[model samples]
Target: MNPPQNPPQDPPQDAQLQADTVWLESIRRRIRSPSQRNPDMSWENNAADLIERQLQYDGHRTWGFVIYRTTYASDADWAEFLRRLRFQMEDMFDYFNGRDILEKFALTVFEDRSLFDGASTDTIRQHFQQWSSTAYRTEQQQQQLEEGSGSGGSAGRVSIGRSPRYRFAVQVDAEALHSVVHDAPAPPELDTTKKGWVKLIDKSWYLGRSEGKSDPLEPIKGVAEEDVGWMKVPYQNVMTEYYTKCRSPNNWSLNYRRPPKVAGSPFD
Candidate 1:
C-alpha cells in the first residue's frame, strides 16, 4: 500500500548496462533457444538438473571470459572469483531456489564489481563503458526479443525475473487477535469507537489499540514511534478490493491487515 521507497542512490555509472558481447551472446542463447527444450543442440540435456548444469557451464564459460577481459582481472584473480561466486550462490539459494538461481544471480554478482574491479572511479567507469558499448562490440541478433532491444529501465537486471504480478501479498483484515491489557488505547478490532483513525496493519506492526483508551483524537501508543516507518497510503490501486470493499463480517481474508477490534473500546 505504501509507495515503494526509492532504493539508495549509486553513482550514474553504476546504472550502466553490461556491455560484454560474450555475455550478451550467452543471454541471447538462453532466452532464444532454451537448450533443454531443443533437440540437436549438442549440449542439450533431458533432466532439469542436466539442463541447468549445461546452461551454467556454457553461460559461465562465456561470462567468465567477458568478465575477465572487461574487468581485466588476472587469471588468478578470476580463479579467486570462485570464492565470491560460491558465497553469493549460497545466499541466493538460502532465499530462493532454482529459478532464482538462474537470472537474479548475475545482477547481484556484478553488484560491487570486484571480480571485475579495476582502477579508480575513472577506470572503473571506463570498465563499465567497455561492457555497455554494444555498438562497438559484436552485437547479436535478439530473436526471442523480436521487439528489438529492450527499453529496459534501471531495475531491469532484477526486474526481468521478479514476480509478474505484485511481489508482496497484501492483507486488508488479518485474523482477530487479542492481546493483554495495557489500556493506552482501544484494540484494533474496535474501529467503530474512533473516527479518522485507521490501522495500517503490516505484519511487522502490531494492530491492537491502547488497553483502555477510547479517544480517536489521541495518538495510539503501539503505532506512533517517530523512529519507525510510517506511511499514509493504504492502497493506491483503487481497483484493489482492499480499497473498495475493506470491511469485516464480509469475511474476505486476503490482503488482510488487521480487523477492527471485536472487544470493548481501547480505554475500557
Candidate 2:
C-alpha cells in the first residue's frame, strides 16, 4: 500500500519553545548569560561588592549617604520614612569561588546596626576593628591547633569601622538591604515638590561636592545634595540630579527629592 500514505512533515520547532526559563518571551532575549553580563560587575567579590558589604545605612542625613531629614515638609505634609528595621545574620559568608579568585581579606559582620552608624568617614576602620574582635574567638581556636603542629587552617581576619547608624536591627541581611535599595524609587511614593527633603538614591552620586560651583539650596553640612567628584558643581542641583536618574533629571532645580513610589504612595 505504498508504505501507507505518508503524513505531511511537521514544521520546525518554534524558537520560543526551544529556550526554557532562559528565554524571556516578552523581550525575546536571554535572561542573563555570563558572557553577556560581567560576573565581576555582579554581587561577586570585587571592590564594589566589598564596599557594598561594608555599607550600613542609618537614614541619618550624613555626608555621602542617603539621609532623610525633617519629619514634615508643609503643614499638610507630615511625612518621613517608616524606617522599618530588619535583621538577617547569615550562618556563613562566602563570596564567588575560583582557584584564581582570591582575596587577602574577607568582609565580616561586626554588629548589625545594633551598635553603630556609618556616619563617620572613619566608620570603615571602626567596623574593621569590630569585626576583628568578633573573629578573635574563631582565630584563637585555629591558632591553638596550629601551635600544636596540627594543620588546622587559620581563618582570615575581618575588620570594619564604626558603621553609620542604620536602623537598629540586631542581625541584618545585606542582600535584603541591597534589594530594598534597588526596589526602592518606584512611583507615587516619592514626589519632588516636598521641601528640605532630598533623596540620595544612588551611591555613586555623592562622591564629589564641587563641580560647576553654586551653593546647594539647603547645603546642610555633611548632607550635600549630591556628590560631584573632583569638580565644583552647584550644590543646589544635587537633589535635582538624583531624581533625574529615576524620572526627570531635565526638571532640574525642583528644590526637593520625591519618594521613589510618589506617583501614588501619598506624594502623588
Candidate 3:
C-alpha cells in the first residue's frame, strides 16, 4: 500500500510583510478622525507600502521625510500642531520597532514666507535652539536617572552620556528648504516644483559638522511627489552610515543629518 502524503502547508509570511501589516494598522487606527488626518496621509501610506515592497523584493529599506508648509495664526494653533505631532511620533515609535529605527526620521516644517515678515531666519533658528536645549536637557536627566538605577549606581554620580543623537523634527528657512528639493540632483522622474506636504525618499544631504562644513549633496535621489512614490535603497548601507556617524566626536547637531550615500543604481 502507498503511504498517505501530508497535505501541503502555507509558506511563512515575509518579515517585511509582517512589519508592513503592523505599520498600516497603526496608521489606520491613528487616522480615525477626519480632523486629525492631513492631505499627505495617502502619500505617507504609499511611501510606507513602497518601502515594504522594496524590502521584500530587493532587500532594501528606504527612509523618508516630509516637507510641511504651515501658517499659524495664533499660539494655540502652534500648540495644537505640536500636540498632534508628538502623538504621531509616539505612535510611529510604538508601531515601527521603537526609537532605534525612528530616531533617524524627522519632519521638516517651513513656515509660509508671509509669517516671516518681521522675523529673520536666525531668530527662528535661535528660538528653536533654546526650546530644544531645554526639552533635551530634561529628557536626558530622566534617562540618566533610569540608567543609573538599572546599573546599581547613584543617580548623582551617573556619567553624562552622549547627547540625544537625532532631531525628531526641524524648522528651516526657504533657502535651506530649496537646497534640499531643488539644489540636489534628483531623478528625472521627480518634479521639484511641487509643494505642500512633499515627502522625499532616499536623498543624499547631511547636516553641517560643528566645523561649519555642510556635507555636499549627491545625485540620483528619489521623490514621492503627488501619486507616484517608490524607491529602493540598500538596508546595510543605511545602518552602516548611521553607526559611522554615531561614532563622530562632534556627532550632535541641530540640523537634520542625511543618511549615507545610497548603494546600487538610482531608483533601482
Ranking by lDDT: 3, 2, 1
lDDT digits (tens) for residues 1-268 of candidate 3: 9999999976577976898788877876666331222322442333233233333342222232222233343545444434444454445444433354444343434455565433432344444444444544454456557667987885542222322122222332343333334443333232233221111221112222222233333422331122111122222222222222322344322112233322232321
Task: Order the candidate numbers by TM-score, best to worst.
Answer: 3, 2, 1
What lDDT would each prediction earn against the true structure? Answer: 0.28, 0.28, 0.35
TM-scores for all candidates: the values are: 0.21, 0.24, 0.29
Using lDDT as the measure, the top candidate is: 3
Per-prediction CA RMSD (Å): 26.5, 14.1, 15.9
Q: Model 2, which residues run further than 4 Å from truth?
A: 1-151, 155-212, 221-225, 228-268
- Residue pairs with clashing backbones, model 3: none
lDDT (Cα, 0-100) at 69 in candidate 2: 20
lDDT of 2 at 46: 34
Tens-digit per-residue lDDT, 151-225, candidate 2: 655434322233222211112123223323333342233323322222232221333544446555344344444
